[model samples]
Target: MESLRELFKIGFGPSSSHTMGPQRAASKIKEQYPNASRFEVELYGSLALTGKGHLTDYIIKQTLGKQTIVRFKSDRLPYHPNGMKFYVYQDEEILDTITAYSIGGGTVEYEGSKLQQTKQIYPHKNLKEIIQYIEDNGISFYDYVLNYEDEHFKAYLFEVLDSMFTCVQNGLHHEGVIPGRLQLKRVAKSMYQQAINTRRESDRERLLVSSYAYAVSEENACGNKIVTAPTCGASGILPAVLFYCYKQLEIPRKELIKALAVAGLFGNVIKHNATISGADGGCQAEVGSACAMAAAAYGWILELNNSLIEYAAEMGLEHNLGLTCDPVGGYVQIPCIERNGFGALRAIDAASYAKQLGYLRKNKVSFDSIVNVMKETGKDLNSAYKETSLGGLAKEFGLKDGD
Candidate 1:
């Protein structure tokens, strides 16, 4: 597995795959051909289907300049759903062509063996191996991460956490309709206000967590800056849980940072073993993985054992299986934002369940097994449900109101 730095990318959202990945690819191509007069990009499959709503073309143009031509092709490349072919031009002559795959979480892989391998930080690639390593070393999961990661990782995580907190704060302060045809009203401020006024402690806690989640998700949907917890689409879940622990439960900042490390370790395992791209694995890969990451982090905050933490992570993904990437109108609104709120609640519930029941019964299905299942399920999902926006909620209601 690579460093947590790759897993948690800080960038302007709405999408990591559609926006961040393509933007990165375009920037790289432009740098490689600095003398090129113009650029042409052809988006394929999921990228083409939802590119307009996700601002894929907008970012590419922003990166490659106004002369860049962006085309949408429904057919997919053999490599990935979020695939693109770039053509560099100088004086109306094609200089070179490059094909790249946005393999989720803002990670891009170029064709023809162009991707350079980063040093693998962790020897263990799956949850079972990770747990065994921790058990043998008599260390916590975060310690296992620290054993492989450089000392600079602590400062990096502090920056990531700071970015997350800033996004949440910014969202809570901004109040207006989100920038989309849907005109979705920003609900985070209202929700946070309601959370502050709620009489029931339990309800207040739930509202606070959900408001934080919504705050981040809303910010992402508005093309605001946010950290990808696993992906931009699912960015809200982990921060929601961790922020709740920090503010409501009064967990120390150092402890919360440790929890972030633990969460990143689990997220790395999932990314290594399965897929975190919604276009590749449906919403399960994005939101489900984020939920699992948050659950594991919450379990760590509660000081649960490895078995219980794994249980919490497993339940988080298991319940979210078959969740489709059905963002209505190809925009990361509607189900996307609401799903983050629910995913946050579910993460907390999963950790609480593991805390209460993990001792009575061992988890039959491991987190590793669930990741495998998730990968297989993502493969089984139809292309329409895999962020193409051809089916599911996107298709059914996409043109009904003409948003």
Candidate 2:
């Protein structure tokens, strides 16, 4: 809780695990050897397994080219198998050739002769030993690092949540209209149109109705290009609640921070007790847990009651108990893109329903029990369904082949 590692991370992605993690790892290596002339990056384990489809290779190239993961655009980055390699220069002197990988969930590792370690092995790679190195050497680190002040941390969380809301609102407005290599689905487009028509309604009302629209139209919603929530694949839930509170409810920024604080609490609980990486626990841990977090946050805002917030989160977690993270062609396209809407809608519903019921009744279900159920469900799930693009909609349907 004091570290804020789980709540905040930096890196590239079509996925937090596959894309962002690798880029973060490479960036850490660059920080380690500011004066090094050359570097090489490599991937191992799960990163290498679905690295290509997840854009792990592309993310590494951008990291090495002196590009921060948070700013690189997926479309502009190179996508070859050896991935992209960058030769850097400082003051007309040739530097190093840097290589890296997108190891999912914003974790990265360095693979080169110049470096002593090949893997970025910290539990939260963004806060790895390299950050310690910077601190030890009295060098400036990235602005995103936590300063550990309650008020300051709260301010940072609110700012990130506000930015997330803005990004989603903008993304939904133009997710499909401005097309990209990834084809747009008609569902999101239709829902966006419907939302436009219903703008005059209360923000909460608009969100409740539009959540369903976006969920049904998952193929079309655009993810946050760089400054986005975890990933487009699980983006909508966090934004929907925040936007609703901001617009319809007229909730203050401080209140929004409270909601997000609650969210971080619940999210960390899951990350510590179960898993968030798709490779480990599948989509349930990602979108499902995110939905649960959002639901809990919304409940916190609505009920002004802690138990109610916990209940709402547990309900959200329980509902998505068996969800999987199977993406077609291993890319975060297909069902992956649309899944965010569903997760968001589910979170909204859970919050609303919990508000109608008393907290005591809701708490009988228990968050711990729900988490256990999720872990069990994940264990029961087929490996093909675990973001491998080998089963579920990725296989039973023609999504993999078509992609």
Candidate 3:
């Protein structure tokens, strides 16, 4: 598996696969063909279907030159849904053409090339292998992560943590409708204020956690800087949970960072064994994987056993198995933003349930089994349900470009 740094990325996001991935690809191509007079870019599948709402074309043009031409195609590449072709022209003649795929989580893969060419950091391929390694070594998840990841990874996580906090703070203070056709008014500020005024502790916790999730999700919807716990569309889950632990539970910075390591391990396992791209596996891959990661982090913070932590993570993804990536108006607002709050709440519920049920009995379903099921379920889903914005809520509410 690749490093956690690849799993957790910092960037502007309405959609990672749509905006961040295309931007990165365009920037790289711009560097390679600096003297080229113009460029042509073609977006396929989900990128084309939702490019305008997700700011894919805008980012590409911003990265390359304003003269860049972008075309949208309905056909998809067999390699991945978020696919693109770049044509470089110097004098009305093609200098080069490159095919690439944005394989989710803001990562790109060239034709016939691996998603990431960097050296593999961990030997385990799946959760089963990871569990065996943990048992054999008699080490905690934190120790296992530290053993494989270098010091630089820890420093990078700190930066990610800071960025997440900053995003939440910014969201809570800002009061305006998010930039999109939806005209959705920002609710995080009101939610947080409501949380502060609440009398009951339980309601306070719920509102606070939900507000944090909304804060980050709204920030992402507005194309602000945020960390992708796995991907931009489902970016709010883990941060909301972790921030709640830090502020509400009073957990220290070191412990939260360690929890992040454990969370990344869970997310990496899912990303390797299955998928994390909404365009590939629907919202199940994005929100589900993020919920699992957040659950694992919460379990780690609570000092749960490995089995309990795995159970919590399993439940997180299992409950969200068939969640569709049907963003209304092709923007990462509406269902996408609200789902973050629900996902964070579900993660907390999953972790707490695991901790409370620790002495009852062992869970029959392993996280690995659920991951396999999710992958198969995603394969069976229609393309319309997988980030194309052609079905579900996107279709139910008839809204258009200016509506």
lDDT (0 to 1) per candidate: 0.91, 0.57, 0.91
Candidate 2: lDDT over CA atoms?
0.57
TM-score of 3: 0.97
Task: Indicate the TM-score of model 2.
Answer: 0.71
Cα displacement (Å) at residue 277, model 2:
1.0
The digit string of per-residue lDDT tens for model 2 on 1-403 reads 2244334453223567666666566667668667755444444434554556666666666666643222222221232111234445555565665555332234333445364443211233322343355456664222223333344676677667656655545445444331333464435545656665675666537545455325322422322343223333565567666766786679987667667756765665565566666766678877888788889877877763545666788888888877877776666666765667667767777888888786346457877678777877876787677766667776775453224
What candidate 3 gets wrong by more than 4 Å, as runs, is 113-118, 400-403
lDDT by residue for model 3 over 1-403, one digit each (tens)?
A: 9888889999999888999999888888888788999999999999988888888888999999878999999799888999999998998999888898888899888884323344678998998898889899899888888889887877887898889889988989999999977889999999999999999999999999999999999999999999998999899999999999989999988789889989999999999999999999999999999999999999998899899999999999999999999888889997999999999999999999999886688899999999999999999999989988889889897753223
Every candidate's CA RMSD: 1.5, 9.2, 1.5
Model 1 spans with C-alpha error above 4 angstroms:
113-119, 400-403
**Model 3 pairs whose backbones collide:** none
- Kindly indicate the candidate among 1 and 2 with the higher TM-score: 1
